[model samples]
Target: MLPVSSELTRSTPVVEYVIGKRQYRSLLEVTSTSTIRGVKKKIEDKIDKPMRYKFYVKILLTWSFRQLTWTGLQENRSLDDYGVRNGDTVRAILTRTSVTRELALDESSPWRKDVSEISDRDTGDWPRRLLHIPTMKSLTWRPGNRYGGKEGPEYEAPEYAALSYTWGKYRDETAEPISIGETEWPVPRIEPTHFTVHDFRRVINRIRRYSGTDFLWLDVACVNQGPDSDEGRLEVGRQAAIFRRAEKTYIWFTTLSEKDWPKSADPDYLQQNIGLFEKILNDPWFGSVWTLQEAYIPAYSYVLDRAGSKLPEISGCGDGTSFKTFTRTCTWLNHYSDTPRVSAARDVVPLLRKSGILAIDSGNPFILYGAAARRRATNKNDRIYGIQQIFGFQLGNTAPNKQTQQYDVNELEIQFTQELLKNYPVGSQMHVFAGSPNFGRGWHANEFSELPDKLPARFIDIFEEILRLDIRRSQNQDQQNRRGLSHLQCLCKFEPRQTESYILGHFSGQMCAFPDLLEAVPESSKVELLVALDYHKDSEVLADLESSVKYLEENTRRYISLYTHDRRRVVSNPGGFAFGKRLKNRHKCRLAVLKLGVHTRSRERSHDVSTFIGLMLMQESGYWRRLGFCLWRVWHPVEDYDKIQWTEEEGYFT
Candidate 1:
């Protein structure tokens, strides 16, 4: 017979245990040497329950509120062996018992009801308190089944894991229905047929098998896609919230193969597999505008390969790894990839920065949009709608309370830019226009050209003039020359300058002499320079010289300040100089200006010349911080400043 002690003993240690919402403090005769089973018995007696149900005692090991790692107390070990202290709080979590049941999808199934009905609130006159998202079918796992069966009353928001994937080209019209116990439920119909039921089944099965969760919130099955349906529109608007509420999000990269994964234990093998890993990351899923929020919003997100194996969490990739690490690796990998989609991948940086997932100093939406312009979205309006969440706007509207307003694709694009300019500082907005490649060219030209009168015109005029020159020059050039000219145009667009008087005055006052400036100027301009110097005493020419000098100094300082504050450091490859560079010498700040390309006397080659100036400030630690960059064509020598002219007839700076 087992010994039973019903009375409270003074020598017993007091322990606090939590079961669901209830907390219990129990005094027992169990010692530090007492096994976990002994403690469980005490808990059962305190709660007045039989020990027939299986439950585990879990202790919180980490402080992460969103994703606390809970370690289970070993039943065979003593309380002290598992690190249970006198007053430590332990949570009892009951595990579901194994049961075999038929999975049936009928009208009574929770998924069949409208989302609005699921909520308990009945706001009769209130303008639909919450969005009515369509109910999506989810599969639950059953114990003792090889192919786990679906078990669901329908998942409440925050109860299921969400899936993010690229549909690719496999848009089958119809396939076999998924088996739910003995009955088969018809797959949710999707128009334009982007995926089949078989595809859905594979994803559902994999998620259930690996995650040990039966219910999954998949966009393809859950979101109604009818063009005119209110359900579809509402779902689109609530997308951010849906993803944010998910317990965990699973990102499925179709291109990732099981064979390519290197053994984690093998260092040499992992090194060789880095290239393949990078290539796998470059898959189209990373470039999709819609997946950006799906990847970042969830508290716990996992990347799954084709075979359902979880890829290493982005944080687990290590400092030696170089897949463009962000503050949170999972967020970075979800929103970015490599190579073919580098531009689109970079666009997410500013959004991440804005969302607080990245450092606050990173650039804003206006600067990022240019890089994202190349990303593909089947619906052109999605280009604008996809990033609304990042800007703190609800889907289809700038704010949640505002009435949903549908606009044409072009109008939506214009409104997005206008909204950005309205919210952020005008100076930063201008700087983005100056830095982005797509802002003042091709389709984006008209948007920037029609800026509201409140915005300063100095920067806009500069971009317009540069763009006009590029367009005129390209009309006469071959395909190769046009491509080179296009690149030059982008460089011209990014040339940083300050139009604000207070900041401009401070920058203009700083003086630095360049002895080699004359040598860098074209020789043919020597005579023109002599002619200009002869008239230096003239007030107009003298004023022009001083004004030009002030402009140059201010522009140089502006670029440097922007570079120092705006650029991301080279964390992975410290030696590379692409984004920013650290100096080997630590004593003082170094300023270097180089004339890029050959200075030519020919009128045609003048357009090809550009100046490259950089400023590097060295910290006491001996590392250099890159401060700024200035790349632009100097039409003529500063000595002949008055002679340098812009002519409509010539269509080029002369």
Candidate 2:
């Protein structure tokens, strides 16, 4: 024991170790290139106990007098990879590992590692787990600065593709076993489960083979749907950002079970029977509200069958870009079929290509809510959550309720509208747009839903018009950029009267309420009688309605070109023009006005010459609900300012 051999000293270096906060330390002789796992094996041999499942290794550092800190190390990496030297102390921190195989993604999976230091957690750069398709391993991926800053060359994030598909009804309500790495873990039977074990195996194998995507983020397997659902809710909040940052988003259509299609089709098959292709393309996948954001966010999105084969017809449209494919498909489908689903698919094309660019790059939500109007979701809140990302904002608190496992759609709408207000400048006329006739929410209003049929399939036509007219009008980019941000120029705020019964606003000329409103009109009701604005068979409305339509047309023409192409639809289509048309007897229906605020025709010209823009509303259960947007001039001058009581405060619409 007096002298150790020179060879032993050269080959094995003594490394110090501190277990947890205990002062006890152990010295182990190991090579400089020994892996963290290899050292852990030596420690287990010395103690005759296994620590892989119970402890994580960390390099303990002492900088100044009694100043101590530690950096966690990956078990598979070597000490040399982290630049750990001999005599450096490493700590073994005790931690709990996932004990059951039933948990879809086990925290103790060998392929998983924590890589939080370099990740941008603030922007949701990290997903909880990623399924490594090549290895068939579900790896835990925590990306944030939450862990102490530990710089290393070995620990770096990998690029991944994300799956966007509707969670269809389960084939059978039974637990299916999935092989995660070498372990066969049982997938839990949750409501709205996506795939059976057989289906999952067949689909993922195809995805890997066809798309050439090695890493995938499939929600059904990646997200935890069991008891620890808090983590699942957190994952849901980060989903939009995850999709935005993903290398590619695969739009998964039907599995095309052998029973249905028998064999995969080529571009010729789709070209030969374009109707079946249209039917295939218009699967429930395209009808999903969630898929809208999924389809539009990524830089490159490929439409794929569950078999993992890219839709030959769509991928063949252009150089594999969705914008090009959607444009060509919309043109082709116009001649092929005019089914409701086909029309809905056509409506989504422009939305994905707003500002004549990809909607994700342009950050334009001009038609976001409108695009979502027709898409279906089992949950009501998804209508807002689905499209909010296109607007460059994500609702942090939109997770499903804990007890009910659903959302309070009413409360969620308020938060959504408020967030939308932050994105636009003050005095935005977007608030005045008509919401979905089916939905009662104020934020649901927009021109897209009002006249969906009127929209031009090609948004580039409108974008070109704006650029061409910009030279003539000499409009600046700033003005053009902020087009939809403000329409009611000199808008003043107004408050609703607190009384149970109060006059809404005065109407001009002899008028009669609609037959439906006559039933709701009561002596004690707040809206005693909704004075009808004369319905003109040719124009939007006889008098008051013309101003709103003109402003909508003019502003859109100046900034974007959608309205110019379909001005007639705005004027004459019974269900397309005004709130009155939403009711029965479209020709006889009259627009009823509820005054929002007064705005000068031109503040530069004269503040005295002002026109008040009112909301086109309908009475329901003694309260008024907005049906569409309406504008009209005030017949009487505002001599008594106190009686009108207009302030610059915020005006909320219902």
State TM-scores per candidate.
0.42, 0.49
Q: Using alpha carbons, what is the TM-score of model 1?
A: 0.42
Report the Cα lDDT for residue 94, model 1: 39
Task: Pull out the clashing pairs in model 2.
Answer: 434-445, 434-446, 435-444, 435-445
- CA lDDT, every model vs. true structure: 0.37, 0.43
What residue runs in model 1 are displaced by over 4 Å at the alpha carbon?
1-158, 168-170, 174-199, 262-274, 313-372, 395-405, 422-654
* Stretch of 10 with least lDDT, candidate 2: 61-70
lDDT of 1 by residue, 1-654 (tens): 112235443232334443331111233455556787877787777656656555665432111111211235567798667654332234444333221011223445433445445321211111111111222332322111111213434222113556787653344456444333322223344333343455556666776666555556665445543455564455566665556544456777666665654334233343334455455546666566676555444434666666566665333444322122323342433234333433344444434433323211121233334333445666666666665654445535433333346666756655565444333212112221222223122212112121111112222333323322332232322111212322222211112222322101001111121212312233342221100010112233223323332333343332211111211221122221211112212212432222211112223544433322211111222222211222223444343433323111100000
Identify the leading candidate in terms of lDDT. Answer: 2
Compose the digit string of candidate 2's lDDT tens values, residues 270-352: 34444443444456665666776776555456666555566543444554444336434444444333444334334434433
Candidate 1 RMSD to the real structure? 20.7
